[model samples]
Target: MGSLVYREELEEDKNSAFTWEVQANNKAYNRQFKQKAFLCWWRKKYKRNAIHTAKYNVFSFLPLNLYEQFHRMSNLYFLLIIVLQGIPEISTLPWFTLFAPLVCLLTIRATRDLVDDIGRHRSDRAINNRPCQILVGKSFLWRKWKNLCVGDLVCLHKDSIVPADLVLLASTEPSSLCYVETADIDGETNLKFRQAPTITHHELTNIRKMASFQGKVVCEEPNSRMHHFVGCLEWEGKKYPLDSGNILLRGCRIRNTDTCYGMVIYAGFDTKIMKNCGKIHLKRTKLDHLMNRLVVLVSFPKSLLWLRFNPWPGIFLMLQMWPKKSY
Candidate 1:
């Protein structure tokens, strides 16, 4: 059996006329209403996360500030001991009374430091709530629509993250518009020029026309095998025909222009693009966490050791001074 070709299918179905009025009206309405609602939802989420972060920041400072003040006072008390040590006659009277204030200062400082540590823990929780998913290793990925089918071409536009890998059927002149950044796929710092009518077998086999692949990361590794397959992508059970000059910007990909499309070879979690991106990010996050823990472990013991040894001389001198008897 001959493999089904998209252009052949469309040519065979010549009786089906393409209607622009309904699609245009629907797209306009969606762009206005649906997109507005999505933006509002995003704003609300950002505000909520900000509030949580603010609360955490406020609480985190309490311990550090309180203990800092206490530590200052302790230093002052230590200074007083040195001053008292200078006058031999004053040391004869019940000099132990002078040590009381220093002891109190040290105690307060220690307690405040403990409280600050607790506050820091709370702050960390708040920070974690904010989306800090930095794309590491190579790229980041997300599934666009779950219900997409074989030979379906889709359109996507600006500020959209790509849902799947696709071929470039049509795109604006790269020099005329801003350069496209594909750091997630390309793993490079510079933006790449987007030339039209480029073909990659993985995503746009059905889209034979000139188009741009928007919203997906450009794969960086030259040696890695790109997965090419035709399957159903989940989206409200409606199958949109993959056509020429149509834009497909589902999931994280966005189309800058209205008149572009590419065949959907894969969608959802199974897309090779998403899986690779996710794996890169996961490994990066784990490494970051491990480094943080290692830093804490290395520094903490050294700090404790410093505190133990340095403070002893002054404390020893205070203990040795003989108290004068009252006449």
Candidate 2:
């Protein structure tokens, strides 16, 4: 019996090492494939003719350098508006009045800059590019130091930002599994089990499991709630219960496991996860642009109307339209 146990242990160690080697080779191949594809695409898109067209085209609003510099200066323009508003007497000066249109132009530019900034930050956070702390094993540290890959096994603790979506591989003995707050994906506040597959889809179209964290988490402050929904998959087979250390996809809720390893089938922009993120970003950008246009359309005519009826007409209109409910 002792001999059998020793042989089994040796076999398990060999298997584990073999799996790790396979994973490493796969990662390297994928990295090279992606790099080559990117270079090919870049060369095709930025050929000599493309550069010339972009430069001399009347529709080209500005050169890339000027556009970037203008964007960086947008915040300063916004600050100038606030300063100008505080001093009403300055508006009466001849020079100030003459330059008021220039100031208005600057304000518009600043507003655009503000919107762009919000969009960029949102995109960065959605894709997990921003700096945040995560648990690798015994230590709690920021992800800035370690370069995480898609298929790598990760250990997450309570309150740590999940570096990437992962599957629960193993839990601490005695079932002391860390509770994960998945409010970013699910709308409910309750903690979910990180154990085996409880839910399975029947349709092959729904067999491909996907977990997305792009949606907004709407909950109260502090332990704020997150919003998550079931993902669609396309597989055909009877749903079997997964073991404790079974593979899980990114964005999965690992309930009872302290450590988990997900086979990184998808990573970067090619993954369904990144596609969903891109969709959310596009939606937010469109909404923000529409709101800004609406505000300007409403305000522009009002300002012009005020200018048209200034002096005597302005005083009479103000007196007649003044509210009498000053109590």
**TM-score, cand. 1:** 0.25
User: lDDT of each model, Cα atoms only?
Assistant: 0.38, 0.38
TM-score each candidate.
Answer: 0.25, 0.38
Per-residue C-alpha lDDT of model 2 across residues 167-285, encoded as one tens digit per residue? 33334423323455455554556875544233321111110122211111111111111122122211233323333233333344445444432323233343323334433211235
What would the per-residue lDDT of candidate 1 be over residues 67-142, giving only the tens digit for each residue? 4443333354445565666567445545566666766766775566557555756664543342311112222222
- Candidate 1 runs further than 4 Å off: 1-144, 172-179, 186-189, 198-259, 275-327
